[model samples]
Target: EIVAAVESVLAPQRAGRLAGRKVLVTAGPTHEPIDPVRYIANRSSGRQGFAIAAAAAEEGADVVLVSGPVSLADPPGVNVVRVETAREMMAAVESALPVDAAVMTAAVADWRTEADSGHKIKKDGSGRPPALVLVENPDILATLGHHPSARPKLLVGFAAETDDLIANARAKLDRKGCDWIVANDVNPETGNMGGAFNTVRIVSRAGIEEWPRLAKEDVARRLVGRIADHFAGA
Candidate 1:
């Protein structure tokens, strides 16, 4: 049954379309520590990114996954590097160089505490909440897209938005210097942020392609297929 399932999952790509391509993927939410026991993070389950990685692997790409803190098993035939903080994630990604494509799927924390207290901070008798200093984290997508060395030929980034989805996604694609931006509305009612299904638009310099709502795994397969087509045409 397991073998049959695997065959069904990969049957569409029996042509070995991406046979020897190298792809890198980032997943999960970076945990920014405030203290020994406290941290800040986003609501990314890493399922979408993991699914993409698996699809790419099944298409015959040599895959490298630089994942943030997530409790998931590594997919078969893919290299997995587990990391926690944003800084660590960035470092791991930079080290895994010279790939054909990169997918920035991780919902990285935009900011982190400026001063990470090594010791646990305790409340004083004043009954007032303590203040926190915030610092911006490096935009991993922008960093990799504009890297001086070993920049991937095709770079993809995700734009999770609540309003002005297409406009904001276009802006991000321009700002981040990535080849493609996958935009999705993550309104709480839509249940997209950590849900099994998604509805998204793929924005590029050419134009926007609105994809149908589908399971995350299906989305991954379609995106991987597009990536394979991109390389073939390039």
Candidate 2:
């Protein structure tokens, strides 16, 4: 007990690459409810994002991870905030401002029903399905990208695309105004959405850096290395 206490006291003095930096990460898929019983969501297991958070925390950054509904356990040495919808995610992200970096990895729903039904939606005897009106949800990345102030020094976004990967990532970099984008192919065949391995490209204004397929944990480590290099030079 005495040795453990001594080690704990001295641990904070260890100089890590991101020791004093603060980082914010968003993970998982937001649920857009249609009614009390049903919701719309994308394919996401939250593994990659959780891996990234774990990696960042390993480097000693003060990390805040905002996540949607997921079964994964929280990463060690990180502060986690749970959320359900895109709007709640936006709010949680905004509240964790003034960080050195922000990673938007959540697969947020683009549109939500104009009005969610309070009760379960059921079919009547008419054999006609109920119509749902959808409206655009808040653009979390864009909001942070164009934030008047309190924007993080490094803003990273993720793009899961089925086609035109680089082109789409480039467009998103400009449209969302983020510093970097981690692009990946999530086609059903690729199996990246919920798989253990991932193939990704790091897209920035400078150019694209293609990384060979790797385990989700290795990808996280490599990304954290890049982040450390970025701060080392900054």
Q: Which candidate ranks first by TM-score, i.e. highest?
A: 2
lDDT tens digits, residues 1-234, model 2?
999999988777436788888999999999999988899997789999999999999998999999999899999998999999999999999999988999888999999899988899888979998998999999999999999998789999999999999999999999999999999899889888899999999999999999999999999999988998999995
- Which ranges in model 1 have alpha carbons more than 4 Å from their true place? 1-15
The number of the candidate with the highest lDDT is 2
TM-score of candidate 1 on Cα atoms, chains taken together: 0.92
Model 2 vs. true fold: TM = 0.93
lDDT of 1: 0.92
- Checking candidate 1 for backbone clashes, the offending pairs are none
lDDT of 1 by residue, 1-234 (tens): 999999988775434678778899999999999999999998899989999999999998889999998878898888999999899989998888888999989999999999999999899989998899999998889998788987899999999999999999999998999999999889999988889999999999999999999999999999999999999895
Model 2 segments beyond 4 Å from truth? 1-14
